[model samples]
Target: MDDKTAELRDIFLDATGGEGTVTERQAERRGSLVDVDDPETVDARLRDLVATMRERYDFATDLETDAYLRLIRGFYGDETDAALADAVGVDAETVAWARLDCHLVRDRDRDDDAPDAIRERAVAADREATRANDRFRDAFVDLLTDADLSGRLTSDSREDGLREATEDIETNVSL
Candidate 1:
């Protein structure tokens, strides 16, 4: 890929926190990819469009949101655009725009032929992160519950306890 393509891909990946692919149906909905001789123009147009879409959809670049998107795509499996949108809590047009973003990222040759394997890896990684977060949250909550700070304690002592508790929990989590 060219420098412009690489940079655009990085931007999309950073914004979405996932390197998803555009399916054939999504490509159809997206109409056509940008066609320009100058990579700079293509990059600028794509960046602006993605920015608008991201803002309009209010897509957060966080693990929880990434997990929800992944789950929606994984479970929907060949479902219609509207169905997927409903499941993911986004409008159908936003769904199309998201696919457009993915298309721009993977359209190195301006063709919608990005491999599904990349998207699969991205989804799996997101799911793994989600699970790890859940485990850490549960462990921390458990520690807080078991501690039961009865009386006022000195700052140093509280800090020490917190450090020790975190170390102990981290040892058990295995993540």
Candidate 2:
């Protein structure tokens, strides 16, 4: 194979968690009906292997696996769920639906959608719910920002001798 073909094969293999070898085994076991040279055939076989992995090992669905792979490859950004879904050959709706169906996503009750009698009670409940959501959001944002800042600060400190400044602060705080 050429360099590009070899690289693509490596990527495909990695995405399937090294299951390309398993695909070869399955093809051998099935007496060579599969044509690995054909792109369509290869995709169909890989899809089947993905399904078998899900059925046998309780692995994530193909869409979820694709999302994870994209994230790991830095192809998906913080707010690019739609792009990730598109790259994975699935829709954003399907990603959400699968997450909800698998209980990986939670459903929140909204007061605006409640009936009149329930609306009043729900409004009160929503106050607490909204507060909780705000707290969670704040915490999540803090974590992401802290992680990003830490990475940048580490790099900058190493480059500009700022680590000594941080050490000085640490020493003063400890006194």
Candidate 3:
């Protein structure tokens, strides 16, 4: 990989709190791998991470949400276009545009309507969340395509499983 690619890979790994190393024997014992090499792999392993972050970390404003996205994206690549798009299902072009919109929206900085700002921020969060979810879906699909898993896991199934996993984590954390 080139320097940029390597950097992006590292960012993604760090964002997901991954150590970026997995042994086959260990995977066999644990039934999972860690520090995935590609977008698909990262998505599969960290499907619940985004939701966990959203639910557990309190964000007071849109700025916080923006910061969260930046942090998550940083874990992938600084470019945003290539790294985020690959991580998510969207094409790099689409991500570029969404990011542009995000920037424009931020630049507008119109908070006169607190209700509107809240609503817009909520929408933005949902958009980012959806993108992250798509990355998980794409990763699962890639796994199925590679015959890494028994059968293709439906998006709904993957989502439900993630939700359950997040709930379990929350329960455990609260204990």
Q: Whose lDDT is greatest here?
A: 3
Model 2: weakest 10-residue lDDT segment is 100-109
Model 3 scores what on Cα lDDT? 0.47
Using TM-score as the measure, the top candidate is: 2
| TM-score to native of every candidate shown | 0.21, 0.26, 0.22
Query: Which residue ranges in model 2 land beyond 4 Å of their true spot?
Result: 1-64, 71-76, 98-150, 155-175
Looking at model 3, residue 34 earns an lDDT score of 34
Could you tell me the TM-score of candidate 2?
Answer: 0.26
Worst 10 residues of 3 by lDDT: 100-109
Candidate 2 clash pair list:
none
Give a tens-digit lDDT track for model 1, residues 89-124.
766545544443333122322334534544543344
Q: Residue 28 in model 3: shift from native, Å?
A: 2.4
Q: Rank the candidates by TM-score, best first.
A: 2, 3, 1
Please estimate how well model 2 matches the true structure, expressed as its whole-model Cα lDDT.
Answer: 0.45
lDDT to native, each model? 0.44, 0.45, 0.47
Give the winner by TM-score: 1 or 3: 3
- Candidate 1 lands at a TM-score of 0.21
